[model samples]
Each structure stands twice: as C-alpha cells, then as structure tokens.
Target: MGYIILSIPVFFLLIGAELLWSAWTHRKVYTFPDLIANIGCGIGSQVVGAFTKAAIFGVYLWTYDHLRVFTLPANVLIWVITFLLVDLGYYWFHRLSHEVNFLWAAHIVHHQSEEYNLSVALRQSWWQGLFSFWFYLPIAVLGVHPVVILTVGALNTLYQFWIHTRAIGRMGWLEHVFNTPSHHRVHHGSDPKYLDRNHAGSLIIWDKLFGTFQPEEEEPVYGITTPLRSWDPVWANFHYWADLVALARRCTALGDKVRVFLKPPGWRPADLGGRERPKEHDRTNYLKYSTDAGANARRYVLVQFFLLLAVTSLFLFKQDSLPIWGAWVLAGIIVLWVMGLGLVLEGRRGALTLEAVRVLLFTGAGIAVWMSVLGWSWWCAVIIFLGAASMIHLTALSGEGEVAGQ
Candidate 1:
C-alpha cells in the first residue's frame, strides 16, 4: 500500500500526459464515466487492502518461519532469483485468474473497461489481494526476506502500469522479451484469438514458454465478452461472484453446483448448456458503456472525484498514525464517496439524493478528523465550501432532468 501511495503522484502525472497525448492526436481514448470508474476502483482496492493486507501477508510470514529449506542472502544474485520467482508466480496466478471461475470474479474488474488507456490499468479489484497472496508464498518460503519480496513485487507491479497504454506501438526487440504495451494490449483484448493470452507480469517470456502467448496482428476489441454495462465500482468487483452464486443455486446436482465455481469462466452445466464460448463481435461496431449526463452533472462528478482522491491520499498517508477505528471510519467514508460519484455519473434513479447525503456525511466526518490536528479551522472551511458547492450543483441538476434508471 505504501508503494501505491507513493506512486499516486506519478500515476496522475502519467495519466495527465496520456490525456494530453490522446487529445493532441485526436484519438479520444477516454470517457469521463470510464475514468471515474477506473480511478474509483483503484482507490477502493487500496481502501479494502488497508485492513486485509496485513493478514494476507501474515500467511506468508508463517510460511517463511516454518517451512524454509534455504536462507538466501540479501545480495543482487538473491534479488534476481526472487524477482524471477515472483514473476513466475504472477504468471501462473494471472493465468489461473482467467482460467478458473472464482479467481476470475476478482480479476475481471481490471478488464471491464471497453476503452484501453492508462486509467484502465488502475481499474483493479478490491478483493484480489485476498486471493493473490497465496501464489507468491513460495518466494517467502525460499528464505527471501518478506521485505525484499514486497519491494521487488512493488517494482514488478510498477513496471506493468506503463504497458496499459494504447499510445505506444510495439517496441522492436523488447516486445519479444518483455511485456510491452503491444503484448499487454493483446492480453486486455477480448477477441477470439486473444482471450487468456499473454499472462505475464514483468516479463513476456513466461507466456511464450508456457504456450499462452499470442501476437497482436489485427486490431483487437477491448472488454469482456459479457459487457458489465454499468459504472458502479463496487458492483464491478463482485457482480461475477453474484452471477456464479445465482447459477449455483439453479443447479440441482451437487457436483454441478461445485463446478460452477471451480470450472473456467463461461462454463455451464451440461443440463443447462455445454461450455459457453466467447462470442464474436465486429471490432468496428463496439459500443462503450455510457449514460446520458448533462454538462453540469459531468463537471460535478469530475470535481467530486478529485476531492475524494485528495481525501484518499491523506488517509493513506496518515493511516499508520491514526487509530484503528478512525482509519476504518475514514475508509467507510471514502468507499461511500466513491460509490456515490459512480452513481451520479451513471444517472441512477435517486442518485442526486444519494450524493447529497454522501456530501453531508463526508463533510461531517472529515471535519471531525481534522479537528484533532492543527489548521483545523481552515480545513473545516474548505470542506464546508466544497460540500456546499456540491449540494448546490446537485440541487440545480435535480430540477433540470430525471436520472435514468440502470
């Protein structure tokens, strides 16, 4: 989480650069609602991780303490081995996330966006940390210190962020060895030939060695075969699990119910239908998920999103010093703030009402948090000003149009 918090500035800088590139090139790669959803998911993931990450890492700590066969030194050679091992683990973990049903429930959020850009890379699942830690436990057991594994892992993750772009073309020779933007774009692609291909983290050689590599030839359609069709970040993270549960409940046989979760995604019982395959769609005819929003509504959502981003950054920076309950309280507010912004952007019924309530709640909670520190008065003033402006915007928009129902 510290790695991510420290990288937030860099993330925004790169995202800004990409936005400028898209505008200057007239490519129009981003949509406002999609950007909101992407950033919301990223912040939500870190919020959830604040509480759950320690426990997840505790499992690896236990593995290292109890099941160690060799104690490697903290040298460059050991770091290289650790890096390769973690990447290998990520490769298989990533592959299984696409192949297995339960894992895909968490992994699918990253691939939900139809638009491919830097923002899409931030659309991560809130619950992936809960499941993905198990895949890297082997490196810990090999006697590489947990800190080293974490540092190297952060570097590995940071390496992948740049590859999520569409601006960069194929790198001449690096495309063969590393996961370049070209290879990663193919991974995010939903085309028939591109599904479940190129599952690499920092290196692309793993996919080639394991027979899961696919080169980009024709332009690929972006997004899941089944479009999510909504901007709700919370729903994006858990909707697949809800679908799996619904399918399992419909099954009468015990084995079929169990297989609903264990089998690959799109799997269906024989009694219902044989294995479902990826549907082919014309690449040129792809329609992105969107909703109608008045200019003021769009501006409101954009402003609120940045406000929430600032609050989220402060929470991350001060989390260690804050009390447990205080941290959780702030996390809850951030989550609601994110969800409220998504609802506002989606034009869901009663969204304005919800946003109004969220504004008041966040303002009250934020004032309480700031009162304990210096400059509380000025902070309180800023909060009230922002909250008042948001309320005004919502009130103004409420009279102009009806929110479309999802």
Candidate 2:
C-alpha cells in the first residue's frame, strides 16, 4: 500500500525535477510522456508479479502444509538478523538480474527510457516476478517467515528509488559507502566503461567488493545502447525479444543463433547475415538523441501529458473503491493514448484525428471524476462513451501543426 501511495507522487516529483533541469539548462525537453509509460510499466509489472508469486507460494505452502516443519520466530534480534539476510539475498538477486542474459531480458524494460529520472525507477518489467522469486527461496528454506521477507523487500525497493535522478551529484565520502544517485546513474549508463557496473541495492559495498564499481565521470549517460524505437508498452517490453527471435531466424546454425541471442545487442552471425549494422557510438553521445521522438509524436505527447494527468487524478481518487472496472477504463484510455502518441511521433498523417479523439476521451475522464464527486449515477459513463466516439472522429479529421513564427 505504501508503494502504491508513493508511486504517483514520486512520478510527479521526477517530472518536476526534469522540468527544472530543462529550464536550468535552457532546453525544452519534456519527459512527461515517458512518465506515463513508466507508470503503466510499474503497475503492470507488479500486478503480473503478484499473480505469479501468489501461484508459486500457493504451491509451496500447499506442499508444506502437512510437513509440520514451520514455526514463526518469537525473538526480536533473530527477526532483525533475518531481515538483514533478506536484504543480502536481494543484493544477489538484483546483481544476477543485470549479469545474466535471460534475466536481463525482463530487467531491460526498466532501462528502456533514455532519460534517467524517478520515472525511470518506476519503469518495471512484467516478466521479472515470474522468475525472480526463485532467488528468494533460500530464505524460505532458512525458516524466515514470508511476511518478514516481503517487508524487507519492500524496504529495499523503496530505498533504491531516491537514487534514480540527475538532481543530486556524488555524495563525497558517502559515495564510497552508500548507493548514491551517482552510483546508480553509472549503472544505468550505456557508456562502454559503465556497462554492467555498480550492481547494488541498498548498499554500494557489493560493487566495491565485487570489482564492478565505477564512479560517475562527466555525468553518466542513461538508457540502453540501442534506444527503443516505439512508445507502445507491448513493444517496449518485447522489442528485445523480437530482436532476439529475428536474429535467431537469420542464423542457420542453431548454436550461432542461440549465441547471438545471448550476446550483447550488437552481435551477429558469421555465415548467415543481413544488412550492414550501424556503427556503435561512445556513451557520451547518448544524451544527444535521448528524447528525440518524431515531431508529430512530440505534439501528441505534449497533449497526452496534460490529458493523462487529468485521467491519473481520477484514477487516484477511485483507486480504492473502483478497482475492477476503474482499472480497465484507465488501462483502455492509456493504451489508446500510447497508440496515438506513437503514431504522431512516427509522423503519421492520421495523428490529427488521434489528437482530437484523445482530447474528447480526456474530457470525458474529467467529467466522470466530477460526477463521482457530486454523487452522480451511471449516466457518467455516458461521458466517457461519447468522449471515446469523438476521439475516433477527431482522429479522422486532424492535420499537422502550423509552423512557428508564421
């Protein structure tokens, strides 16, 4: 519940920081659309994680139900030690999530955003929880209660959130001891030197002890080496999967195909090949193209930022009471918004229509929230329906933005 409560505010904080940085630097870059995408990623990942873990734990408890093997610990010191052990367990799991290729597939979604901010922290993987619990089973075997493990895990995750930003520079001596923003920034960096470095959670000692530590030099470059080409959540999550599959198909030798898939993004098969690959760049060049979506999409995202904020406000209000239907409505609106944003970013002519449709849909969300506050009936749903229909019509009639200084 604390995680859910803080998620929205954390998002806004990140947005505020991004805006301030842009203003200070005299650049107009906006990361609000990226924030919306991250919100989807975070909630989606947790929901998928919860269901997967529930099933796995159900089987574990059911199998152990008859063993008479468990007793909840009563001592306070032992519980504290157990919690610390859990953090240590997470240290290893988090480390492996970056080191192992198979695990990295799920972990990569969080690093997809080119801009590093609190929103990047929220960008999570839908598939991470499916396999991540295996790393924690040792705790269960050691007789630590699952409740204690969960509490520690939540704390470990919460502690890492503050480290995702450019607002705070290195923390002098604390840089050597704690997982500061500088250390985590290096972790997110695609700089050849920074790749696979600083893989710690809640403690920086692991990286120092493990020989993977690297201090932030000249402001770390964020995002994966190969930037994601689309804004769609499904594409964002599975783009690497698709890339792997295509690489596998291109390789005639099974071993080569498997190897290519596991190797870093730029690998290629020797005998069977495709077009010439693009040249790789020094990590320093990353920021140049970090938020460079096409023109139409930028406009669409600008509107989306405003519109989604309205929808998000409503979602927050009804979050506790309207879990089932409200979730779907919010999800549907978000999906369409991403689609529209992508189309505009790609310079599609139909984006004008999408823009119109989105405005109506957003207006409907606003009206629905207002009605709910005023104690209205199901007629409120009609606003969303009409808004959705208007969105479709708007998509059909929209055009390109007028040139500046006309």
TM-score of 2: 0.75
Candidate 2 lDDT, tens digit per residue, 1-406? 4454456676577668777887898864446456656766765665445336568776445433443255557378757776567666666777777665566777889888777777778788888767666666666666666666666666778788878877777688888778899999989887677887888887788778878889888665567877775555657778777777877887888797678646644566667553334344564544443334445445546655565555555554555565455455665666566556555544455655655666665566546645655556665676567567556544433432421111
Task: Give the 10-residue window scoring lowest on summed lDDT in candidate 2.
Answer: 397-406
User: What's the lDDT for all of these models?
Assistant: 0.88, 0.65
TM-score of each: 0.96, 0.75
How many clashes show up per model? 0, 7
Please, what are the lDDT tens digits per residue for candidate 1 over residues 274-339? Answer: 799888887577677778776878888888887888898899878887767678778988888888
Q: Number of clashing pairs, model 2? A: 7
